[model samples]
Target: MLDIKFIRENVDLVKRVVKNKQLDISIVDSVLKIDEKKRKLIGEVEELRGLKNKYASEKNIEKGKETKLKLQELEPRLSEVEKEFLAAIYKIPNIVSSDTPIGKDESENKVIRSWGTPKEFKFTPKDHLELGTKLGIIDTELAGRVVGTRFTYLFGDAVLLQNSLYQFALEVLLKKGFIPVLPPLFINPDVYTKMARLSPETEIERYAIERDNQYLIGSAEHTLGPMHMGETLNEKALPLRYFAFTPAFRREAGSYGKDTKGILRQHQFDKLEMESFSTPEQGLVEQDFFVSIQEELMQALEIPYQVVAICTGDMGGPDFRQMDIESWMPGQGKYRETHTSDYMTDYQSRRLNTRVKTKNGVEFVHMNDATAFAMGRTIIAILENYQNEDGSINVPSVLQKWMGKSKIQTK
Candidate 1:
């Protein structure tokens, strides 16, 4: 949620940014109206409460029957006003950064730059689905029968390939001074929504449990983000680094038809996420650290990729600035996003109530998060790029030891 005060000051800018994100502006208008009503109620409620207190403290209690009645009359109204204020606060979206580009969808998104040319194949390249099945690495149909669509069973050497990604990502992140954490797998909506990078339009992506207050985490960033919730930390610990590995879940709603054929997207998948906390004084530096780790991971895996700065319209409120690492997929004949790095610049910490107290006093900490690795997507990238005509995958030199072979040969 955005601070009502900030929204009040930046209504025009908020309206424009909302348009760029391809979001509904009507809700934003309603929020502003609700905010106005709440503000008026606060002043009115405070005045009535002060008068009630004054009346109660007056002398000559035998003559105070009229005062008692007036105080009782004001109580219900004050309660009603507080309820409205709380509701308005919950609906407010965080203020987006000023630099966001004005556009709708990825087509409108500006490409800052790209890296590493797409690999040229001497032979016709096979898509991941064809390559994986032929290599005896992925069994989508059987797994779909056992569970459902969008689920897969990794066979042959795929398991080792997936494990190898986690091993490599964790090592690189740790060397960057990131503390490895195993966060809680589930969290209540109050905390989840508090730091989550979700919006009203994207609500379908979230998986909420009807039976309980908890929801399965979509990303480790959710847990890592609220770690300092409602707490103040020392200034010296300004840039706190953390890396986590977990099986992330999503409802995958609204994305019904796209990428349903392969593990390009899935409901449950493993990922290595990196999160950082820094003071306003050191936010960009912390952001660079995250970007560096993403690049380092790609280089170590020997994958060709490009880095692009996301336009303001492409980013949500929790992210003040964003960048994506897109890997080359020769089979797909194009680059696709595999990792994203974000600089949230106090947006999340403020909402989650995570603050730091320096010599100058308390302030919200800026947050940064990046995808160090997603096991399934990484596997897909590897299978497509490293596939051989004989249904084999030449393991990257870095991961050869982990797979226990130089190549994965289909039986």
Candidate 2:
């Protein structure tokens, strides 16, 4: 949702971004052409309206009737042209930051830094699935029968552990000046459209309730991002941070045979998400702050992880820049993505009509959303990293109090 003026002035840069992001370059040309027609029609409509007004003042019935006919024809044509122009413009993605890396996919993503060290196990480690099953904490077999694949029911300590993770994440964000919110799990199609900038491809990934005309939210950010839709906020409240926990549902379309065993890629999962609204100058800072918060959470958990700068092609259309925090999972013998931060600039705000009244006048607010914790994946990291040789799971010190025990073990 870039400003058309910016797109018009920085055509070359926009083209380069489209190329780097693997988007349709022809869309840029289409937008310009449609906009040209739209502008011309608008001018013609205005001129005809003016003539109609003059004819009325002069009491010229014949001229007035002709002008009225011209206005009716031009107005509808202008409306059609305007619709085409808007559709074309929406197809254009936001310009990437100058510093954003140019690459085709995740393989080229740059790891800016890493924290902690991968643990060395003297004995073979079992994945979360095995550990949970042995400890009678996770039941996937029953869930498969009840809800189909990629679903699981946590029993006993696993339930406590997941809830503890939620509490811990909420506390961390609350201390950082973020207001906690519990948004509706179901959102109207209109709000979701603006929040996600729904294109045909993305629309397929959502779970739509056809009868209700609502879609299930895929993340807390989905709802949080549109909280101020079509509103103008006071600049004095520059940065409004919200932390939310929600049960997100997704169709998981096109993602088959990947992490299907565990809760990593589930049709339904819980997540703690952070969303913020800030002035343009503060967007990047807010992004960095979110990454810092992520790092802090990872460090507190004492898990090995890395911070990656997402390449152009790997980023979402609305993301100006993005980063992912991948935590080590010993059972999987690799690092798995646990959190992501997307700096959308004004891409989302423009569609949401979320603006702020600043000294310079009203302007679209820069929006950012990041995962504080994906509960299921975070639990996977915890289960794999904190497992003892004897099949007991040692709770992270920070969560021990909430769990009321230091270890989860079978009786």
Candidate 3:
């Protein structure tokens, strides 16, 4: 959530951000009005409490009783107003960086650069689904029958490939000083709310274990981010980096009839996510470094991909700036999103109460989360890019050691 003081001082600018993000502009007015009322009520409550204490000290029982009654009346209202104020303020999105494009949606996202060239296949390239089926490595049809759509079972080399992806990413991140963690798959609703990704508006995108009062995490960062919630870190730990491997669950709500045939859009998928907390001044640079690591991983796989700067409306409310890596999918005849890096600045830290003690004072730390690899999508990219004419899939050279075979073919 944005600091209320910042919102008050830059009302116009905040409103512009709301408009650019395609949110209700009137939320600014609502939040300001509620803040004014809340502050007034707080003052009245404090004043009444002071009077009650003063009267009691002076042995004026009747006056003290009246003041106490007034306090009781106002305190409940103050509590209500405070809740209302928080709800309103949380609606305000983080201000986007000046360099971020001010466009409405993904269509307006700018492609910053690209790496590698899409291979020219000698035969008609098969999509990952067809290749996986022919190789007897992926079975969505059986998974769908057992668990419904957007689910799949990986057999044989496909499972090995996924594990290899995780191992490769973990090694890369470990050498870069990132601590690897296996975070909880479930999160308390309150903590999840403070993470600010799953709001009342987007809660449907996540799985809720209603009985347990917990929500299944849609990403590893969801759990990794709040590790130091409500704590202050020493400034010397300026950039605390971590990478987590977890099975992510998503409802895929409202995403029907899209990528319905493959593991590209699944209800359950494994991912390796990179998350970090840094001093404010180093936030943007930290994000760039994360993107660089993402590029390094993709390049090592020899997959052609482009870097895209996500437009305002295309990014999440907590993202001050966002970028994605879209790898070339020859089977799909287009580039598809395989990795994303988000620089949330202090937007998330402010809510999580995750702060850093600096030379000056304690302040909210900036947060960043990016994809090391979304196993399913990366696998799709590899399958399509490295498929042989006779329906075999050559493993990426880097993963060959782990797989112990250069190619995977039908038994």
10 residues in a row with least lDDT, candidate 1 = 91-100
> Could you estimate the TM-score for every candidate?
0.91, 0.98, 0.99
Q: Best lDDT goes to which candidate?
A: 3
Give lDDT tens digits, candidate 2, residues 132-178.
Answer: 99999888899999989988898899889988988888788888899
Runs in model 1 lying further than 4 Å from the true structure: 26-28, 60-83, 86-92, 197-201
Q: Tens-digit lDDT track for model 1 on 205-293?
A: 88777698678888999898988898888888768889899989887887889889888888888889988888888887877777877
Q: How much lDDT does candidate 1 score? A: 0.77
TM-score for candidate 1, please give it. 0.91
Give the Å shift of residue 3 in candidate 3.
0.5
- Give the better candidate number (2 or 3) by TM-score: 3
Of 1 and 2, the candidate ahead on TM-score is 2
Candidates 2 and 3 compared by lDDT, better number: 3
